[model samples]
Every structure is written in structure tokens, then in C-alpha cells.
Target chain A: MREIILSFPKQFKIGFKAAKGIKVLGNFKKLLICGMGGSALPGEVLKIWLKEKEIKLPVEIHRNYSLPFNVDKKTLTIIISYSGNTEETLSAFKKARREKLKLVAITSGGNLLKICKRSKVPLVVVPKSYPPRLALGFLFSSLMKVLTNSKIIRGISREILSLESKIKLKKLEKEGKNLAKKLKQKILLIYAPEKICVLAKIWKINFNETSKVPSFYNCFPELNHNEIVGFESFGKNFHTILFIDKSQNPKILKREILTAKILKEKAVESSFVFLKGKGVLPKIFSNVILGNWVSYYLALEHKKDPLEEKLIAEFKKKMKV
Target chain B: MREIILSFPKQFKIGFKAAKGIKVLGNFKKLLICGMGGSALPGEVLKIWLKEKEIKLPVEIHRNYSLPFNVDKKTLTIIISYSGNTEETLSAFKKARREKLKLVAITSGGNLLKICKRSKVPLVVVPKSYPPRLALGFLFSSLMKVLTNSKIIRGISREILSLESKIKLKKLEKEGKNLAKKLKQKILLIYAPEKICVLAKIWKINFNETSKVPSFYNCFPELNHNEIVGFESFGKNFHTILFIDKSQNPKILKREILTAKILKEKAVESSFVFLKGKGVLPKIFSNVILGNWVSYYLALEHKKDPLEEKLIAEFKKKMKV
Candidate 1:
């Protein structure tokens, strides 16, 4: 697990190269990225990054089986399944192919890859050793490359190249360890600015999968509207982590501060993890690594295997039968 | 709160009339529904209903400030704010107006009303007595009327008219009370099939605001991929409630049964609430009303004021500063 985390930065380079020759020819007006669980995550990350950069294309992330009803020829559908066998993604892929919609795919070696080859759908096959969650870097960068190659968006090669140097793993790991200690025996709640709220979801998933704990998340401004009230009469073992980005609106910044203060008054505990690093990719991936570390160390604290996801495997097997 | 729930069905009739003469002119390719908290919920409900009916137009629900980056001339932007003053929706309304995009507004009365009138954007003003969350029937039906008037979708007038008769409130309230007693003093986790998962979210928010308890939710197929694993070492007082619809894919139905069995094996408690009612509106609204009663009765059990939201008021006051 430690080695996997250490080697994570290399995924950007490899993922970029893997998609070098793959491209779709279309004047796509929008995007529908379909996947499930960890495979669905890169679309989320990409949506946030694209929003931050003010890309005008609407990117809808779908995690369910079959295609979202709105999908049309103008909508470019990108199917992602790390195992190349995710049932829902394959279902969507089949539907998209039947509709003759412009399509692309990202996977390792599995049914998704095989079908993509049969259909001549553009694809990028990444390494498949790690669990889908741990293989985020590969999935995300490959999807980014697909967008760039298809001329759906401008190239971020320079940003991708610098991502490895920007990540300070040891510092983030130490901080994550400290966070895990504070979060020990505590149900986790995560919040981030709305546009970048996907980071909070990613953190919650890490805590849930790696640490084997029930963690939940929602974005700020919106959470302030409803979820904040849930803490008014807090009588549970809950700890909140706020991912603050200094680049966000000052009003949101103030709301975060006041939200934390109100939670404190209600006897709910919260800690802030400022998103630190230059550029959007650095800021996001740095925090992503930080969360990975927190979950890793917490797994050790709980005497759990960080790499084990027996329940998912079991459910999938049952699903097949 | 109980009275609000009781009169909820009437909102459908009243809301249908609210937009009787209102309409928009455009060749909309998609939809961007901007809102927050309770105000945002109708869009979620509408999306699920639309998907079930196989409406091909894409509806994107936005909860944050300003507009989603993808908003363009071809997108019909519907801004909803029960108070007519929600900050985020107002911001989106302003952006849509500035961009000269086709726009509509739904509200009881607030700055949103003033702005829409000033700009000549089509608007529907429903009765403003209930809290936004409590006014789901009004918000959702009015939005539907707007779509109907614009010819974006066919009228479900018959379905909306029959909704009240479909709800057996006395029977559902008893069930809600029993469920509330079971959920007492436990953190709530909700799951529904992916398309209708918004009901799970609505239920979670109801539990949070009405009962002042922390709650979380996720959809099936996706949760099966990642979140089910979190229960592997469950160490908290978490109670999961599954909202199952018999109309869904048999594969999903099998997954739900298997998921419940596995949760039991892991010693995590779970219960199933089948979504029972004929037609889409009845099925959705019945379960929605059931959740409301559970939260209302749970509030009584906790001795919390279901109608009181002092924290939200305080947050709003502070945000104004």
C-alpha cells in the first residue's frame, strides 16, 4: 500500500502516454462520463477542474446503469472501468454503442477493453494491479488526455508534468497521520467549497474504504443551507474536516469560519485542512494524497488492511450469479 | 410541521395554477436548475420523474453560487428559491439574465421576485407560508408547470391531480411512527436505486433538520462498489434504510436484497422501505410523505422542535453580515 501511494505520481506520465494515439473525431457540445465507484471519481475530479478553468462544456457524471436519457449524438460519452468489467459502465457502453454516439473508454484489461476493441472505440488501457480507488491518478490523467486529444479541451501537459514535483508526500503523510489521530473513534464529516466539493467526497470515500469507517460529505454554501442544522443538537461521536481553498470567494471563506465556530459551540469538533499548492491540479492532488495518507494511517490504527475490499468483491461475485 | 405535511398534497393543485399563464420561448437543448437546500429539491424530484418517463432533455441541478460554467443560450435556466431570496439562486438568476439566456423563476416572494419582475423573466410566485423544505409540493409542481407551459415536456396534470387521493396519510403516519421509533438514537444512512436516489437525500435532510440528527445517503450500484465496504468493520450506531422500488432492474433488486443480507452478516443494522404507489408521482410523493412523518415523530421522540431552525436563521443572519 505504501509503495502504491509512493508510485502514484508516475500515473500522470504513464496515463498521458497511453492515450497519445487515441482520439475521437467529433464536435461534441457536451460530455457524459459514465462509471461506478472509484472509476466514476475521475469524471468528478475532471468536472471540478474544468469548472475551475471556466471550460464551457457541460460535463455530466453518471454512475448508474444504461445511459442518462438526455444523451444524444452531440454528447460525447466516455466510459471508464478500472477492471474493464464494471457492470454499470459496460451497460452504458453497450447503450452508447447502440445509439451510435461518439464514444471513448479508459480501462485496464477486461470486458470494457475487449468491447471497445470490437467496436473500434478509442481507448486508453492503464495498469490494473491496484484497487480502483488507488488507481485514480491513472484513470484521471488518461481521461484528461482523451479530452485533450479529442480537442474537447486544451492540453494540460505542462501542468501534468509539474504535478509530481508539486506533491510533497512526506509532509502530507505526517499531516494525515496527525489528522487520523484526531479523527480516531470519530464519525467523519467533510466539507469543501461547492465547485471543488468533489475533493470532500474523495476524502470521505478514502475514509470509508481505506479506514473502514462511515464518513459522509457535502459542499459548503449548500451544506450551510441544510446539513449544518444537523449539528445543532449534536449528540454523536462526529468530527468534521473542512478543506479550505483561499482562492474561493471571500463570502464562502467567511461562511466556513462561521460554520466551524457554530459547530464548535454545538460541541461538534472540526479541523481545517487548507488546500495548499500552486495551480489547480497541485492543490487538488496534494489534498487527495493527504486524504490517502490519513486513511492509510487510520487503517493501521484500526488494525485493518488498507488494501482489503472483500465486501465489494463479494458483492460483485453475488451480482454475477 | 404536521399541518404542513397534511396540506402538502394541496400544493400540487395550487402550484399547477401558479404558472398557468407563464411560459418561455426558446429551443432549449437542455436545462440548468439552480437552487439550494429545500428550494433545490424540486429539481431533484423533477429530474427523477423525468428520467422515469424517459424525457430526453438533460436536467442539471446546481446548489452553489453563480451559474454552472456550461450555461449557454440553448440551456433553459430555471432559478428556484422558496424564499425568493436565497443567495446562490439569486446569483445564478443574475448570471443567466446577464448572459441573455432563457430564464424562469419560481418563488413565494423575495429579491428573486423583484429581480425577475424588473428583468421581465417569466416567474411563478407560490404561497410563501411554509419553510422551503416543507413546501416541496409547491416547488416541484410549479417547476413542472413551467416545463409544461414551455412545452419541454407533456403535462402530468392527471397524475398531479390524483396524487392527494393516492396518499393514505393515516396509514403512512403509523408506519412512519414505527420507523421513527426504530431509528431513534441512531445515525441514519439511506439508499435508493440510483435514478430515484434523491428520495434518500430528501429523507436524510428531513432527519437532519426535523429530528436534529446526523444522517447520510448514497445510491445503489455505486454504493455497492465502494460504500458497502465501509460497513465491513462498522463500529458506529449506524442504521441504514433502503428505499426499494419494484419497478427497477431485477439486477438492482437482487443487489438490494444481497446488500441487506451482507449488512446483517457484518452486524450493521438495516431495514427496507419499499416505494409503494402506482405511477411516478404517487410512488415518489408517498415515500416522501412517509419520510416527513418519520422525521416529525422522531422530533417528538427527541423532544426537539421540528419547525424550529434557529441555527439556520443564525447562519443566514451571519451570512448577511
Candidate 2:
């Protein structure tokens, strides 16, 4: 886990070259990302990142078996399975092929990799040492390369290379430890602006997997409409972390502040983290790295192994039978 | 609350004609439904419904300020604000207009309605008598009408009309009350198959609003990959309600059963509600109606007012300032 966190910046460089030999076919009307768990998260992050950059094409993430009903010749489907063996993703990849949709695959060396190779589908191969959840940097950067190659996004490699020196891990760890202290015994309610709301979800997943804690996330503007009402009954068992990106729409920013204030009045502890980084890529990565540290520190505080997922292993084992 | 629940079937009929005078323009490349809370829930339900029927165009739901970056001339943007005054929906409406996207509005007479009127946008006005959450029938049916008229979907109105006679509310209420007894004094983790997952979300909202409970939802196949792991640490405080649709992907149905079994091994109580309806529309509505009764009965058992949303009202009041 520590190695994955420390090597995040390096993964960007590795990911940049991982897809060098693959050529992207442009003119797809939509992009469908198929994966589950950690593999699926980067797609969501990319969706918001693309939205923040004002990209015009719709990006959809499908976490289940089969491609969306809308998958067609005009759709580009990317199948991601870090271990290369996730059943749902394999199902989706085969369905995408049967439907003859343009396809890409990202994996280490599981069945997904073998199938892609046999089918002559484009593939991006990353190293397989780390757990899928900790390999966000490689997954996200590879996806960025695909988008860049397809001409859907431009000049991300420069931003990604700059991120190596820009992110300060030690400082993030200190901040994470401080925040973990406050969040130790509390149920977490993470809130973020809509553009970067995926970060909140990432945080929830990190907390769930790493710290073995129950957490939930919601985005502002939307949460303001309904979930804000929910905080009234939650009491002191909840602590909210608001991910505030200054670049978000001013109205949403105001709502975030007001929401924190309301949470305080309702006696629910709350804190705000202004998103770091000048560009969307950096901002998203910065928040993700910070969340990783937070969840790790939370695990340490709880005396739990950050890498353990016994129940998940058992569930998968049971499914195999 | 009782009036709204008992008249849900009638609301579907009322919603069928809610947009009679409005003409839908065809040939849109994408459908973007913009709303929040109850207004937004229908769009999610519609997305799944369209998927079930194999509609080829992508349908996306936008719950925050402004439309998705993909909104264009070929995108059909529906703005729904039951009260016509929701700030986020209003913001999206203006943004859609500025972008010159095709527009439609569904609302009671509020600021959204007036603006749509002045802007000459096609509008669908449902009755203003019920709380927005309770007005799902009207919103969903009106949306179905718009989709049918635009040729994005076919034959939904007939299914919705048939729902009136097919759905037995009294029986649903009894089932709901029985489930509510089990769910009382427990945190809820509602699970559903991906196709009808919106019902899980509707149940969460109903529980939060009516019973003042903290509830969360995730769909099958996806949950099997991650959230099922979190259940190990969730303790006995959490009770899970699995909404099982018989027609879901066979693998997903197996995962749902296995997930319930795993939860039992973890000592987390769970119960399954097999969806009753034949088609996606009827099935979704059946679960939603039953969820409504469950939440209502939960409120009654807890001696709480099901209709009250004091924190939300207060939050809105503060936002206006």
C-alpha cells in the first residue's frame, strides 16, 4: 500500500508509455467503460475530468455484465480488469465484441489480457504487483493516454508529467493523520462539488476497504436538494468531509459552505478540504492521493491491516463455487 | 401521505396526460434529464426502463447546476422541478437555453414553469397537490409520454395505464408494514438489481424523509465486487433489504442470493422482496410503491410525521437568503 502511494507519480510516466503501440480509432459518439470495484472508479474520475474540461462526448461507466443497451458501432468500449479476470468485465468485453463495438482493454495478465491479444483488440498492460484499488494512478493515466490518442482530450501527458513533482506525499500524510484523528470513531459523510464528486466516492471506497469502515458520499447541489434533510436525524455519529474545488460553479460553492454551516448547527461535525492543483488532472490526483493517505492513516488508527479484504476474498471464493 | 399513496395509480393516469399539449421534437442524439430529488429520480427510472427495452440512445441524468458538457443541439433536455422553484433545475434550464439544446419542462406552477412559458419551451405541468417525492407517478408517466412522443421509447403508456389495475396497493401496504416491523430500529442497506436499482434509491429517500432514517443503496453485480466486503464490519446495527427482480441477469440474481447468504453468515439480517411486476415499468413502480408504504409504516411505528422535512425546509429557507 505504501509503495503504491509513493509510486503514484511514477505510474503516470509508466502509463504514458504503456499504450504507445496502440492506435485509437476516433469518431465514436460515446465511450463506455466496463469494469468493477477499483477498476471501474477511474472511469468515473475520467468522466468528471472530461466534464470539467468541457469535452462534448458522453462517457458512461457500466459496472455489470453486458454493455449498455446503447452500445453500437458508434460507441467505443474500454474494458478494464486489473487482475484481468473480473467476470462481469469479461462478460461485457465479449458482449461488446459480439455487438462489434470498437474496443480497448487494460489489464496486467489475466484472461482479459489473453482474450484481447487473441482477438487482436488494443490493450494497455500495466505492472501487476499492487492491488487493483491501489493502482489508480496506472489505471487513470492509461485511460488518459487512450483519450489523448483518440483526440478526445489533448495535452494531458504534460500535466501528468508535471504532477510527479507537484504532489507532496509527506505533507499529505501529516494532514491525513490529523483528519483521521477527528474521523476515527465517526461515520463519514463525504460531500463534494458535482465535477469532482467522484472523489467523494473514491474516499468512501477507500474508507470502506482500507479502514473497514462504513462511509457514504453525496455531491453538492444534488445533496442540497434531498440529503441535506437527512443530516438532521444522524446526530453526532457522523462527520462530514466537504471536498471544495474552487473552480466549481460559484452557486455550488456557496451551497457547500452553507451545507457545512447547517451540518454544524445540526451538531454534525464537518470539515472542508479545498481541492489542490491548478488543472483538473492534478486536482483530481491530489485529492485521490490525499484520500489514500487518509484511509491508510484511518486503518492505522484502528489497528487494522489496510490491505486486508477477507470478506471480499471469501465472497469471490463462494462465487467461484 | 395516505392520500398520495392511495392515489398513486390515479397519478399515473393524470401524469399520462400531464403533457398532452406539449409536442416532442424527434431526432435527438441523447436525452439529458435535469432535476434533483424527486424530480431527478424519474429520469434514473427512465434510463433503466429504456435500457430494458433496448433503446439505443444514451440517457443521462444531471442533478446539479447546468447541463452536462455533452448537451448539444441534438440532445433533448428535460427540466423537471415538481414545485417549479428548485434552484438547481432552474440553473440547468437557463444553461440549456444558452447552449441552444432542445428543451422541455415538467413542473407544477413555479418559477421553472413561468420561465418555460416566457421562453416558449414545451412544458408538462402535473398537479401541485402532493409533495414532490410522492409525485413520482406523475413525473415518471409524463417522462414516459415525452419519450414515447419523441419516438425514443414505445408502448410505455399502455404498461403504465395497465399498472393501475395490476398494482394492489392494499396488499403492498400489508407487505410494507410487515417489512417495516423488521427494519425498525435498524440502519438500512437497500440493494437491488441494476435494472430496477432506482427503486432502491427511492426507498432510501423515502426512509430518510419519512422515517428519518440513515439508509444507503447499491446495486447488484457492482455491490458484489466491493460493498459486500464492507458488510463484515457493519455489525448487527444494519439490516439489508434486497430488491430481487426475477428477470435480472441470471449471474446477477445468483450474486444477489449469494450476497444475502454472505450477509447472514456475517450475522447481518437480510430479507428479500421479489419484484412483482411483469415488465420493467410495472416492476419498478411496484417496488417504489411498496417502499413508500414501508417508509410510511416505519414513521407510524416510530411515532414520527411522515410528511415533515423540517431540516430540508430550513435548509431551503437559508439557501434563499
Candidate 3:
């Protein structure tokens, strides 16, 4: 039996309260989130849930080590570091404070907390104890609360609650009823736009680390330009192409639909999963729950034991550098 | 033995001669090439080569469907489609021409030819036979001839001869002799300014198509800020990390070395690939030659014929709607 590692989720009340407690910070021009991996998933959820919301400022995620050189004081940066010690987030926190941009931070503890204390930036302390990846729901909901309170987005609370409940509808993936399990022998290609892309990325990472499967995620509109043509060669050996389609610009949306359809006809097997939701948080959460459950099922499907990551652990131990 | 589809390149002189006879215009403020896999490699080669050139016009290769929205009349757009049918390139070409930007075309034949002919723009045609992947030397040399004629850069004759010799070096790449073969299961994280990132991207595409590996190319100091930290978690599942290190600024150079060392410590496996050349054409061609040889060798290592592409053929036959 594979050792599965996951805590029975705490009463979803913590996330619910945090999501309900978001407050508006007046005068921020753009909502910028500087985060990586699990911490960043929340921003993606918010963006996707709020796709229809008239976003006044472009919300950009800084996944690299530094912020774009052109950032100005008008930017509202939310620095996310699970350990609070994440180096890149710390670098960005210092830079944001140096420029005196408005700031917020999410973490249990680390240099982020220290810097936020020194700089007097607002802090939202998440519950510590679990891996950062598992903390995605809380982080994502909190970020959504902030966006909604700031009026950059409206109506996300119900979506979060809705997603929390709907996840049960996907059969609570115990053992045999898992879609992700089927993906074990195949490469997982998660395709989506800005918000969904983050969820997809998180899902890919989860599959890689937990299941030890090589998976990938990419954004749309961009993929159509180069990667679409690439599939002309992927053939039957290529198992699946999953498109997490949400609402997008009419023309670009059509391009995606047409391309996915063309690829399906061209390839041995492909899947087009169109998803919809009331708010960004809910919609992103919707995909997150599906991916999470499916990957768990996939873990069981491959009989790889859902819990062990011997390769990653061994690599880390050997490298101590 | 597996069935052979695409064969090892046999005759190359005609391709080389055709490449030697093209011309590029020189009045624009910036050079932007609309390119996909085949000729895109040349764009990257030129970026590296130009760093050492006597006179250099800043060049950008738009790899996606949309030209950077910042593009305008001062941009000299070169649309490159080896088969002359890439949709993204065509889209950008249409937009560039519609905006009245000066345009040039490199293609064998397709709508690109008609668009250029009817619009009175110049077109340089190559013989359409070999895989676009194998035809990089011809395309790079041809583009160089154009740039040289248009007075964008100097030292073309020498560059072509160098490219020719380099292509010869890539033939029948065998085990220990093929550098590219060793890079399988590695990442080509290229770091350059947006202008030069084109070169790095070409290296990545070559690895993906020719070598069948996962590779990445990104520009810096943007990378300095973000992606560098990913090494901490990358620990060791990877085989290597190759930086298409070019001779550039002293500050950027120092940062790159430090970044590589940090990544090396963090990576499971890694190495640095330095690019050497005296002008735009030579450097670009050199990298391509090295990459091509490496990939060919890698294909051989897998005990599979390098030229067979059964999947892509099937994709063409089955894709519909």
C-alpha cells in the first residue's frame, strides 16, 4: 500500500472566515501578486473567478525571482511565501517597500513576517503545519476576499462556498473512481488561460511530486501559435490534451474551440473540458477540486502509491548545496 | 529496424547557394522577425552573433500570434515561414503590413508568397524538400545575406563559410562525438534581454523537436529575480541546465555566473553552454550547429533513426475541423 500524506482538511470554517473578512484598501491601481507554486494558486483562482468582472488594473503574477523592471509605486503587491522565508518573495517585498508601494503578505512565518513587521505592511497569517501546496485553498480564498473587498472584483464568497460543496459531487474520488488515475501512463497537458493556468500548473506540480509523473501546463492563445502545430506530430503516443476552457474574448475563445476540435480529429485521443462558474475563486476552485481528486485517483490507478516521493527526497538529501 | 520517413540530409549545396543570394532592407529602427521553429533558430543565432558585430540593429523575433502590441511603423518585420504556412506568423504578417510597417518574407511557397507578391514586398524563396528542422543553415545564411545587403550588420561572407563548416560537423553525430546528445533530460534555460531571448528560444525548440527533450529559454535579469529560486526544489530529477551564455555586459555576465553556480548547487544535474562567435550570423549558426549535432547524436543514442517522424505524419492525415 502506498503511503498517502494528507491531513483531514480542517473545518473549512477558517477559509470561510478569511474569505469573508477581506477589506478594501483604497487607491491601489494594479493588483500584483508575487508568489510561487502553491501560494500563487490563490491569485490564479481570483483572476479566473473574476473573468467577467471589469478589472480596472491588470493583475499580473510575478513567478520569477524579481518584479518587472517597469513597476512603479502605483502597484499593490501581495507577496506570498508559504514559509515566509521564500527568497524571491523576500526580495520582492524589500523592493516593494523600497518603492513604498502598498503591500500585503501571506505566510505562517519567515522573513516576510519580519519585514512586514518592520515595514508595517498588512499581514494575513495562515495556519501552519501542512505542506504549502495543501494550503492552497486558504491562500486562494484569502486573496479572493481582498480582491472582492477592494472592488477590483465582486461576488466571490458564494463561489468559494459553492466550490467547497461541489467537490463532493465529483464522487469524492476514493479508489477506483478517479480520472487522474487514468492519466498515469500518459503525460498530463493542462491547458488554460491566466487564472486556470495557475490551477493547472499547481495540478501538474502535484501530479509530478506526489505521483512522480511528468506533467505540463501552458496558457492558451499563446499555445495556439506554436504548440498547436507541434501536436501535428504528437500522434497516438500522445495520450491526452485537456483544455480547461473558461469564458474568454469571443474571437480568441472561438480559436481555442476550433483548435481543440481540430486536434481531437487529428490525434489518437484528446479531451476538451469546458468549465464555467459565477466568480473567479469558485471557477478556479472547481478545476482545483477536480484535478486534486483525479490525480489522487490516478495515483491509485498506476498503483504508484499516492504518497511517496523518494526521488525528490533523495535528490534534496544528496545535494545539501 | 524502424521504417524511415524523413531521411538523413544528403544534398545541401543548393540550399546553401539559395541562402547566399538573399537581401534585407536597412532603414528601420528595429528588426523583428516573425518566425516559427525552422527559421526561428536563425533569429536566435543572429542575436548572439550581433553582440559581436561592428554595427547592430536591435532585433526581436515575435514567436507568438500577436506582435508585441508596442510594435509600430519604425519596426522592420520579417515574416519567416519555411513552408510559408504558420498561422501565427501569417497573423503577425497581416497585422504588420496592415500597420504599414516595412516587410520582408522568407518562405518556400504558401499564402505568404501571395501576400508578399500582391503587396510588392520582397520574398526570398528556398527549395521545399528537407524538414524545416534540417534547413536551419540555409535559412540562417539567407537571412544573413539579406541583413548584410541591407547594411544591418557586417562580416556576412565569413559567417556563411563558418555556418557551412559547422553544418558539416553535425553529420552522422555518433555517441561521444555528439555534444547535443548529452543534453537529453536537461533544461536549456536561456537568459538574454527580450531582444536576444530569441536566440535562447531557438536552442530550446531545437532540443524539443530534434532531440526530443524538455528545455526552457528565458531572458535575464528577469530570470535573476524569479526562476533562479526554482533550483531549490528542482534538486535532481533533471540531468543538466545549459545557459546559452553569450559575451555581453560585464554586470550581466557576473550575475549569470553566480546564478549558474546557485542553480548548479540546487539542480539535480547542470552545465553551462557558452556561445562563441564574432558577429550575429556566426554566433547564431554556431549554436544551431552544436544543437543540431547534439540532437542527432541523442536520436542515435536512443537507437532510433533521427529522421523518422511517424507521429507528425499521422497528425496531418487525421486532423480535421
The candidate scoring highest on TM-score is 2
**Runs in model 1 with CA error above 4 Å?**
A98-100, A115-121, A232-236, B98-101, B114-121, B232-236
Using lDDT as the measure, the top candidate is 1
Ranking by lDDT: 1, 2, 3
User: Residue A265 of candidate 3: its Cα lDDT?
Assistant: 64
DockQ of each: 0.64, 0.60, 0.08
Error of 2 at A184 (Å): 1.1
Q: Compared with the true structure, what per-residue lDDT tens digits does model 2 show for residues B162-245?
A: 888888899998999999999877778899887677888898889888887778888888777666655445457678999877
Question: What is the TM-score of each candidate's chain B when compared with the real chain B?
Answer: 0.96, 0.95, 0.72
First chain of candidate 3, TM-score: 0.76
Which lDDT tens digits does candidate 1 get at residues A191-228?
99987888898988898889988788988888887787
Q: Over all chains combined, what TM-score does candidate 1 have? A: 0.95
Number of the predicted model whose DockQ against the real structure is largest: 1
Report the C-alpha displacement of residue A38, candidate 3, in angstroms: 1.8
